[model samples]
Target: MEPAMACHADRTAPVFQTKGLTKTYRQGDVEVHALRGVDISLYPGELVVMLGASGSGKSTLLNILGGLDVPTTGEVRYQDIDLAGASDRELTRYRRDYVGFVFQFYNLIPSLTARENVIAVTEIARDPMAPEEALDMVGLASRLDHFPAQLSGGEQQRVAIARAISKRPRVLLCDEPTGALDSATGILVLAALERANRETGTTTVIITHNASIANMADRVITLSDGVISGEHRNSERQDPNTLSW
Candidate 1:
């Protein structure tokens, strides 16, 4: 990894910093506040899990941090770049080069094989891993030729993860990665995420409603009513296999 590609290897230096961040959406005559005066810092290579109910600002905060949306007020800084003020082109470039997003849906092409799906992303990335290497990292080496229709829900999601990390993004943002799977399958998905983090040292933030998933995080952040409610750090992270919903 180049110096810029390294995901916050410097634990003391922040990869993402947000100050007094607020987001509001106008729905006809009403305004819905998504994030209100939120201040937080994410270190390099840290696995941070965000826990909150619906409308709690967890996904809103993640979207802002990932360059998918701009804040209404305050500041969002990814390193020294000011995201809140970045132009649409700048934000698009930022997302393409530095961010990897995984949603609840795998979004894999049904016609493409697993390897082909991963290759579609690696081809556009700078200093990316090969499609095979990426799948191997996510423990899908044996399933490379399998199409989305042939794989289980967890396996398909793993392919999504492989596609995301093949670019070697500095930050990995996952929203409800396991929301569509059962407990047994969810653990497998979480395990793939944990393994990717360990191998690539990508700064990972996962948004989840499951409290048990907190055990795998280096830090746990909570939000309520569009504001930060609490934050905590674990002395040591737990194995994903040991976690349950």
Candidate 2:
């Protein structure tokens, strides 16, 4: 293995690994390569931020890692399971059993109360925290009965965080989670994710264009034109409360 793709000498097996990962989308005579020969490993309980400009393959990488999409080439290993080689049934089970996702927009059901929305996920999980407890973790305990329209943007985002973590997924994949919120609100939403990572020891990966948010992560990976352009490991991560927007 190349030194760049090698795990730290002191580190154990990675929670996630990608080897020569590639994804290509065909359109008639043209082909768009979303990812090319990407090699990386992510350890457990670490918070990672992916920084990239538009068309940089950040979203594509996140999708493949989360089992929402499969790569055209290469492999993805989630612990002992090789995701790229998993059958559709196995992929479905893997997503349900191990992965959680958060996106820019809160996809809460309008008719359901905050607690109900969270319970929707817990109901399907094999082992899950109480919906009320999950909401409390995101600082939404008092808003349990409120519907989506009754909450502010940040509160709605918090509810979404509660939904994602209710199942206690081993990995959390967030894609532009704060893109739709104001800076102040975005900070709070980011804090919720940070708290989840710390409290549950869940490995977290966030994809963002906002460089300001990178300071809160233990490592940052920057991608350009479907390849990793830079990889940085921070010596210390600032508490989310101290992070600036």
Please give each candidate's TM-score: 0.95, 0.94
- Model 2: pairs clashing at backbone N, Cα or C within 3 Å: none
Minimum summed lDDT over a 10-residue window in model 2 is located at 1-10
> Runs in model 1 with CA error above 4 Å?
1-10
lDDT of 1 by residue, 1-245 (tens): 11111222347889999999999999999999999999999999898999999899999999999999999999999998899999999999999999999999999999999999999999899989999998998889999999999999999999999999999999999999999999999999999998899889899999988888988888899889889899998767788887766
lDDT, residue 71, candidate 2: 92
Deviation from native of the Cα of residue 111 in model 2, angstroms: 0.6
Tens digits of lDDT, candidate 2, 105-167: 999999999999999999999999999999999999999999999999999999999999999
TM-score result, candidate 1 = 0.95
Q: Which regions in candidate 2 have their CA more than 4 angstroms from the true location?
A: 1-11
Global Cα lDDT for candidate 2: 0.90
The per-model lDDT (C-alpha) reads 0.91, 0.90
